[model samples]
Structures are given as C-alpha cells and as structure tokens.
Target: MNILFVHGNYPAQFVHLAKALAADGHRVVFLTGRKDPEVWPLTGVEVRRFELHREVSSEIHPYLIPMEQAVLQGQAVLRVLDVLAQEGFQPRLTFAHGGNGLSLFIRHLFPETRLIAYMEWWFRDETSHWCFPSYEFDQRLRTTMRNSIILQELEQCDVAVTPTSWQQQQFPKHYKDKIKVIFDGVDTSFFCPTPVKGELILNGLKCVQPLHIGENSLLLTYATRGMETLRGFPEFMRMLPPLLEALPNLEVVIAGDDRCVYSQAPDRADGSWKQALLEELGNRLDLGRVHFTGSLMYGEYQQMLNRSDLHVYFTRSYVTSWGLFQAAACGASLMVNRDPATNYVLKGDQAYWVDLDDPQHLVDCATKVLKSAPERRKNIKQSYLKSEWALGNCIASWVELINAQLKV
Candidate 1:
C-alpha cells in the first residue's frame, strides 16, 4: 500500500504512525517544508521537500494574511503534487495535518484516494483561545477568518481527528460529529520513572547557568517548549521566589527555550519573559538553587522527571502539553494550574492545582506538596496511563482507523 502524508514539519505528530506503516511493508511518502532531513530521518519513509517560492504580500489586509500564507503554502505543495501525479503515483491514503493549507488542493489531484485530516484545534470562539478575549470583535473576526481553511478541509476530508476530547469539543457543534478524538499517544515505558536519582545535570540555557542538585536536594521541574504566559510561565515564576524562601533544600530545574509562541513579549527591552521575570523578582529569588536549562535532551528530561519532587506545569484550557503527561508517566508529582485540561488528567490527590490569578495560592500549594505529597507521585500514573493513550494501544487504533478508511 502507498500512503501519503502532508505536514509542514515532517514527522511532527506522524512519527510513530509513519514508522508503523513502513514496518508494515507500506510505501510511505511524506511531503514537508522541512529543509533538513538529517534532523529526523525515518528509515523507510520517502520525504519530499517542497519550497515556498513566493511570499504573502505585506500590503494585504491583516485578516486575509493567514489565508494568503496558506494559499502560498498550498500552491507550493500543489507543484509537488503535480509531479507525483505525472509520475503515475496514486496513494491509497493521504493523511494531512490541517490548519496549514498545504493539503487544501490534495484531493483535487487524488480524487479516488481517501483523505484524512489531523485536526489540532479550531478557534471556535474567543474563549476557546487563551490569548483572545470575547469582547474583542476585531480579533474575533480575524480568528473566525483563520478557521476558514480548516473548515474547508474538514468539510472535504473523509475523516478528521483531534488529539484530545477537549480539543474535539472546541470545534463547531455541527462539525463536532465529524471530528474524532485520537490522542497522540505517550510512550509510557520510555517516560516511566527512573530509580537512580543522585545528581542533576542541566545542559544550560543562554540566559541562566544551571545549579547543581545533590543527592539530598529536593528538585522542582518546569518543562515546556517555550517560556510563554499562555502556559503560565509568569505565574509559575512568581511562585518560585516564595516557594524557595520556604524550602531551603529545594532546587529548581526549568526546561525550555526562552522564546514565546502563544503569547506576546514582556514589556522589556530584550522581550524575553524569562529575563523580564528574573529582573522583576531579582534579589528575592535564590539564584544558587534555581537552574534554567533551555531545551533538554530526552535522557536528561526523563532523569529530571524521575528526580522531580514536584513538577509544575501551567497550560490553558484547550491547549495540551505532552510534558505534563510525561511527568505523570514518570510518577512525578504535579503542581499545575487549575484548568479543565490539566484537571482532566490530574484530579483528586493526583496533583496540586492553583489558579493563575493567585500567585500566593500557588506558593501555598507547592509548599504543602513539597513537604507532604510523597505518595501523590503514584496517584497520577495510575489514572494517566490513559491505557488507551498508551503508544501500543493508540497505534493499533490508528492502524485500524487508517485501514477502515481505505475500505470506504
């Protein structure tokens, strides 16, 4: 069987599924805008690189800019598609990650092949997105326009899938039935707890040199791809000073780059939220015990998770962060923001939750958990194995879903 995949970033969410297909003796062709193949080279999958030869005009209206970018991306992908079509290549299935317009014209060429869209999220309303406010009419209009491409793809595709129930619920009521919740499974065995915990090593961030956490040191972890307000970086930072003052033995290990993706820059010269927060809480924070390691390798991350006395995470209502789930898998006790998404996985005594509005409450919760929550580590692991969200189980379901679509 010939299977085609369309993603701007190759193997973003398709890592496990693509490898599974290739191992099953299927020819997997991937179309991506990723320039460097060495970064992630799947053994059997053939990756085709597409170049965006044109750019969206600066003069274009703000609301139309997103669609313009998608159209340009779609045109670049179309060029690649045209070549494949001429070469007598007809895939049995085309799996596309929606949001980008790359796969917008895919079905036009391969009319017989079934198209399946990987639905991440749709900006259903202002409340659904953490950054937007419902009262902001202009921003809401722009967001509604942004969803046009995704809606088109969703309407046309044979199947559409979102990673979580929360994300699935974010779509329109009419389209809710069309979207299925298929989580991007977590590898429990790989992320499971490590028994050895003696020393902590941080690869080092550009802004902060890492501090050492000895054998007896109590470690607190915060991991994310970027230090953004949407994920509660600022609120988390505010809790750090007071939490450190309370516990002298506590050592902090922060994992992630000092970049913002979902939120605006801080009101500072450098615009780094990390730098701004540090400046804001300057002498109050004990620099000796706090460590900031930009982006950790998997081995380092796993070790930190295992060693973490309390792993603090803060994500908005609809957004899903894999780091939290990994922390859960590693039996890391969580101190997270109070949101339905986090509450979904970490409930009851599994995690220590606090609202972003009250930094003092976060400090209070962390202090209590650090002093007493020894058994809470195991509590989260039990519920979160989401046995259904386990890699093997979900992969099997993916195979079944893909094969089922092929038959239709």
Candidate 2:
C-alpha cells in the first residue's frame, strides 16, 4: 500500500497511524511544512517539507486571514504532489488535517486516489462561535463568512474524519453521512500510571535542584498548550487562591506557555494573562507551592499526569482537548468542567464536573477531589483502559477505513 499523509506540522494527528503502516511494510511518505529535518527521524517513513510560494497579504481583510494562509499552504502541497506524480509516484490513500487546505484540491490532481480530510472542527454560525459573551455584530458576520474555505474543502475531499462525536455533529446534516468519528487514540502504555521512582526536572529550570514529584505531597496538575481563555485559564487562576488556602500541603503544577491560543480578550497593557493573574493574586497564593513549567518534555508531562493526586481540565462548549484523555489514561483523579452537550467523557463517575461560571464551585470541587482517597478514583482509570480509543485500535480502524475507501 502506498500511503501519503499531509499536514503542515509533521506527524501531528497521523503519527501513530503513519508509523504503524510503515512498520507493516506499506510505503509511507509525509508531506509537511518547513520543519527541522532532525526533529522528524521516523524509520521506514519518508518525510518531505514543502515551502509556500507566496504569503498572505497584510492588507487583506482580517476575517480572511486564516483562509488566505490556508490557500497559500495548500498551493505549496499541490506543487509537491505534482512533482511526485511526475516521478511515477501515486498514493493509494492520503490523509490530511482539514484546518489547513492541504487536501482541498487533491481530487483534481489524483482523481483515482482517496483523500480523507481529518476535520477537527467546522467553525460555523453557531453557539460555539469564538466571540462569545462579548459578541459583536461585525465579528459574527466575519465568522459566518469564514465557513467558505471549510465548505469548499469539505466538498473537494473524498471523505471527512472527526476526532469526536461533538465535532462530527457540528457539520451540516447533508454532510453527516460521509463524516466518520474516529479519535486520535492515546498511547496508554506510555501514559499509564506507572509511578516514577526518581525525581523529574522541567524545562527552563536549573538542574542543580530538580523537583521531586509524587513525593509525600498532594499534587494537582493543569496542562494545556497555551494558557488561554478558551481553556478557562483565567477563571482557573482566580479560583486557585481559595484552593491553595484550603490545602496547606497541596502543590499545583501548571504546564503550558504564556500565549493566547484562542479568544479576543485584550492582553494586559504590561504583560500576559498569566502576569495579570500573578499581580491580582499577589501573596494570596502560596508562591512556593505553585510551580509553572513553561513547557515540558513528554516524559515530564507523563510523570505530572501519573504522579498527580488530581488533574483539572476545563474547556468551553467547543472542541475537546487531548489532555483530558491523557490524564485519564495516566489514572489521575479527574476534575473537569460540565459543558452539558459537549462533554460526554464525564459520565459514570469517571470525573468530577464543576460549573463553568462558578469559581467558588471550582475551588470547592477540586479541594474535595484532592482529599478523596486514590482507591475511589480507580473507576476513572479503568474506564479509559476499556475504551476503543487506544493507539493500536485507532490505527487498525484507520487502516481499515483507508483500505475500504481505496476499494471504491
């Protein structure tokens, strides 16, 4: 089988599947954006980086920024596919992340090939619009227009794949039949709660005094790619003072960068959202016990999940985060937000759900979860192990789907 995976970032959602196919003797090649060659050294897989021929104009409408960027990047990918075709290369199947328009026009290039756009989210005129609570008429109009790019790509691709049912439900009813709900499975073996026997160190910290996690201390972990409003970082920070005040031995480890990934909340005139929180909660929080590991290595992150007494994950009624699944896989007692229709993972005593609007309730819920015995939280971990989202299972399902598409 000749398989080609396309994503601007190398091996993002396709990592496990690509590696598995290559190991199974399938010819696997990746078309990625300009990334460091040394970073991706996957054996049995060929990696090729494509360069954008042009850039999105600065004077273009602000609403069309993402669409414009995707067009440029998509053109670059098409050029690479053209070169490969000239060299007698034809992929039986191609998988791409729909956010970028990489697979938007692939059908025109290789009519015989099967292209599956891995649709994460389709930002349409809905309740989950980015400019919520502070919605502006102009912003809403802009968002409505942003769907053009996604709609065009959705039509161009042979099929679509979404990681969650909530995400798949976001698509229009007409396209629902063609969309498949397949999660990017978690590697339970690497993420399991095998207690670490040694001390762990975080990035941007001196090694002279490495932090000894999972020691005789009550640990609470909150992790995300960016500490932005979409993930409810601001409210979580505000609730932390009361939580820290309640538990004297509690140690909080926050893992992420100080950048805004979502939301149009104006940054503080002086610094970031994190800095603003630090200023507002000065002396109120136990500074010694609160550690911020800017970004962590995979090993460090796994240890944080496995070692924590309780892991807190909060998100709006939007796309779900992979961190929640990873936390569950690591056997951590989960404290998550109740987003009603969006959060389907908190059923059957798997996680403690808190109200999205109440900071006091969050503090009370987390504090109680921290005090609860580890034996009571075994259900959360056991539920995850028995699920269908394990890495091997997802890869097999993905291969089967691709093979089925090729047959047609």
Best by lDDT: 1
**Tens digit of lDDT per residue, candidate 1, span 1-408?**
889989999788988888889988999999999898667789899999899888889999999999999988988888998998898889999988898898888878889988889988778554445763232778778888989989888988998988888788778889887787787888887988666445776665443544467867777889888897778888888888888888888888888988887656776678798988898899999987777777777887888887788888888775688888788877677877777777777656767777878877888888988876455444434424567777888898887888788778
My TM-score estimates for the predictions, one after another, are 0.93, 0.91
lDDT against the true structure, each candidate: 0.81, 0.78
- lDDT tens readout by residue for model 2, 1-408: 788899888777888888888998989989989478547578798988889988899999988987888888888988998998898889988888886678776777888888888887777655546435466777777777667777887887888899878888888889998898888999988988766544445553322355665455678888987777778888888878888888877888888888776664455574477887888899997878888877777888887777777888988767788888888787777888888433676565777888869888888888788877445434444435447778878877787888789789
TM-score, candidate number 1:
0.93
Estimate the Cα RMSD of every predicted model relative to the unseen true structure.
Answer: 2.5, 2.6
Candidate 1: the clashing residue pairs are none
Q: Candidate 2: where is the Cα deviation over 4 Å?
A: 130-133, 197-209, 269-271, 340-342, 373-386
Q: Where is model 1 poorest over a 10-residue stretch in terms of lDDT?
A: 376-385
